[model samples]
Target: MNEEEIVQYFKCQLQEDTNVATAVAAIKTLLEFLKRDTGKDYDKCKKMMSERGELFLKRISMSRNKITTLCCPFIKDGAKILTHAYSKVVLKVLEEAAASKNFSVYVTESQPDLSGKIMAEALRNRNVPVTLILDAAVGYIMEKVDLVIVGAEGVVESGGIINKIGTNQMAVCAKAQNKPFYVVAESFKFVRLFPLNQRDVPDKFKYKADTQQQDLLEEHPWIDYTSPSLITMLFTDLGVLTPSAISDELIKLYL
Candidate 1:
């Protein structure tokens, strides 16, 4: 299928699935499979797409497992983790940690959608200790946090991440407090885009808030770029890596 068709197919799937990591993986795998289609052979394309879909599912499962197994070691006894927004991979690691160890999580009410609240409730349902906070309170809670872990929407070539709008500030706070800021993401989330500034990020990520007050609309953004310099490490399926190591991996895999 063409790009538009592929996008629409996944858009429908996204409406049915709330996990960003899964949707992203599915999209990436489908696109990669299509990119290798040299002939417009419909029958062969369907067969290949089906195979790619199965591979995508398996990759997602393994990636989550690898991340949780590797990253849970960081969640020591009585550890306090501060997080922004909701990432399925991040939640999986936290869940795995809580199953065997005692730890607490502080989630920011990532605004526009308050996805952090959703994350907090998910953890509470699992009987894991959790605290909810406002997006602006990250700095206030930084001192008490042993580590900062969040999810990524996309990881650019520069090693920065596009994530919930408040994540950049949260990373900045963690850096200032000498805390480790980590990102939980699958390899598929890495893209070639190298965004230098907030303005360089894709416009599609900007939220259009509809409110009675005009100024309030202008202030709401769905996502923002967090520079790699602020991140302590990235917990990816490939392994735990420094931000600077991302480029080498991308070259080995895709170049």
Candidate 2:
């Protein structure tokens, strides 16, 4: 295996594996194997790459199909959509419905990673009108937006959403504004860990550096959780779900 072959194998394995840790371990092994094999097999590598691409497309198609069936009907023409973070599902939904000429999106410039900037650029390329706002502006802008959509990193059985640090504030604002807030995520992100209280939620914040003049450490970490009630809906590869509906839908995964 060469570089291309190793990448293709990783993609293929990712398509089949739902366990994040296991998938990562498998990719590491594949990379190690490729490093040991110096011989480059261009033809074989190309074939594997093609197959991996096809599998990637298939998985995306599956997710798109589910979202189209479950959520498209609820989208109003010319609605203002608000989203934070970068999500393939959210992008695909916008793309699939672009012809409707029905929606414009507002995206936050998610700090630290600034993933939202990448999403904004992609949406612009697709000719989707996007309003890029700072994280703090979300509440102020929420009143102007008709809907709130966010991507989740992990979802608990109790229906709390673990996402970018600012996400909880966004959800809180959306609730205060009485706006509909939705989470667009894949079912794989759901986690079994149930926090007994808000305090039980992990402290994703960490100190990164210390400035001598300021006498303070600069901490930049990721992730926060929003309580279940703050979310209006959850869109997954399976379907649109309410917070209360999550546990039942998740049980199907075990079967």
Candidate 3:
């Protein structure tokens, strides 16, 4: 595939799965095999792509497990946790913690899609107490929550996170209340993005299809960027890192 086609394919994959890591894995596999495809027969090239795809999936799963394990300690016994949207990684962390710690979770009814119900249902199945609230209630319940933790679609170079639209509101409330706002994400979700604001986020992430076809004023953005200053820490497969750490390191290396 040419660069433009590959980029379009990646966007479609991401929108379908709602998982950046999986999308990246798919592209990585394709890119790695693209050169090999030029010299190999069709069957051989197909087999190579299949094998690489499986490896990337396994690695993604392993990293998620590692991140879950690393963040387990934060789910203290009887804690009142608040989370937004639906994050598989966040769910895994809570599930692992539920094995021992007794805690209740409050999830935002992330608007436009209302994915929080899915998260709540999943937790209920596991016997974890969960309360689903409207997106606007993030601050109303902030005082009752011990901490705010959410998942990310992307962790940008500025150390800010792009996640479900309501996340920034939750983060702001957390900061105002002096509550720790944490992000649970895999290292692969970290990208070399530098968004100055929510609008600065790439359209591919905010919209499900080609941006030029849509009218922004009438569109509901799928996600928004939360500033690094609002976050207390990030629990990633790589390790627990302060937002500044990501900025200092990613910028120094990538820039």
Worst 10 residues of 3 by lDDT: 13-22
Candidate 2, residues 40-112, lDDT tens digits: the string is 7645786999999999878867876687556666668898999898977778777777767668999999998
Which residue pairs show backbone clashes in model 2?
Answer: 78-102
Displacement of residue 21 (Cα, Å) in model 1 is: 23
lDDT tens per residue, model 1, 142-193: 9999999999999888888999888999999999999999999999988888
> Candidate 3, residue 240: CA error in Å?
0.8
Candidate structures ordered by lDDT, highest first: 3, 1, 2
Off by over 4 Å in 1: 1-41, 208-219
Question: Ten residues in a row with the worst lDDT in model 1?
Answer: 208-217
Candidate rank order under TM-score: 3, 1, 2
Top TM-score hit: 3
Q: Write the per-residue lDDT of candidate 3 for residues 1-255, one digit (tens) a residue.
A: 886687677777654545465767767776776756765576786799899999999988998898888888877899999999999999999999999999999998888888999999999999999999988888799999999889999899889999998899899999999999999988778789899897788776887644665566677788999999999999987789999888766655566
lDDT of 2: 0.78
Q: How many residue pairs clash in each candidate?
A: 0, 1, 0
